[model samples]
Target: EENRKFVLRKFQILYNRVLWIRDIESTIVIVIIIRAGVYTFLLVIVAFYFSNKLPLCDNEMTVCRISIAEVV
Candidate 1:
């Protein structure tokens, strides 16, 4: 019947729209996660490089204090 066909067409359009929205949301989430991971990785690398570059101290107590402060 014409009515049934019209209903089916409407359902298909709605289904397609939902699928598109879901795909867009998934892509956004993936992009955010990837960016966060990259930022974290870069932060760690910079921290490691700075730790090696900076002069701490000869004494154990001074080195511990300085290193702890630098890490934060």
Candidate 2:
């Protein structure tokens, strides 16, 4: 019947909309995750570079050990 066809079409539209929203949300989440990972990597590199540049006290072998651990 025409009424049954109409109901089926409506359901199809709703299903498509739900799928579209889910896809958009997933894309946003992936982008955020990538950005966070890149930022963390950059920060670690910068910290390692600066740690090596700092002047160490004569008895501060622990500082060097800690810096090497962070780079690894």
Candidate 3:
């Protein structure tokens, strides 16, 4: 019947839309995760590089003090 065909077409359209939205959501999530990981990796590398380049504190009493080297 024409009514049945109409209903089927509507369902197919809705299904396709849902699938498209789901794919977009998953892609966005993957992109966000990758970006976060890249940023974290860069942060760690910068921190390690800075720690090696910076001078240590000279005061014996301040054992836990962090000393940043002054850049001229």
Task: Count clashes in each candidate, considering only residues at least 3 apart in sequence or on different chains.
Answer: 0, 0, 0
Residues 4-59 of candidate 1: C-alpha lDDT, one tens digit per residue: 99999999999999999999978975665565555545555675688965333333
Task: Estimate, for each residue in 1-72, the C-alpha lDDT of model 2 and write its tens digit.
Answer: 999999999999999999999999789756655655555456556766888653442257555444443454
- Segments in model 3 whose C-alpha atoms lie over 4 Å from true places: 36-72
lDDT of 2: 0.66
User: Which wins on TM-score, candidate 1 or candidate 2?
Assistant: 1
* lDDT (Cα, tens digit) per residue for candidate 3, span 1-72: 999999999999999999999999889756655655555455446756888652333233133121111110
Q: Which stretches of candidate 2 lie over 4 Å from their true place?
A: 35-72
Q: Which stretches of candidate 1 lie over 4 Å from their true place?
A: 36-72
Name the 10 consecutive residues with the lowest summed lDDT in model 2. Answer: 63-72
Point to the candidate with the largest lDDT. Answer: 2
Report the poorest 10 consecutive residues by lDDT, candidate 3: 63-72
Rank candidates by lDDT, best first.
2, 1, 3
Instruction: Give candidate 3's whole-model lDDT.
Output: 0.58
The CA lDDT at 49 in model 1 is 88
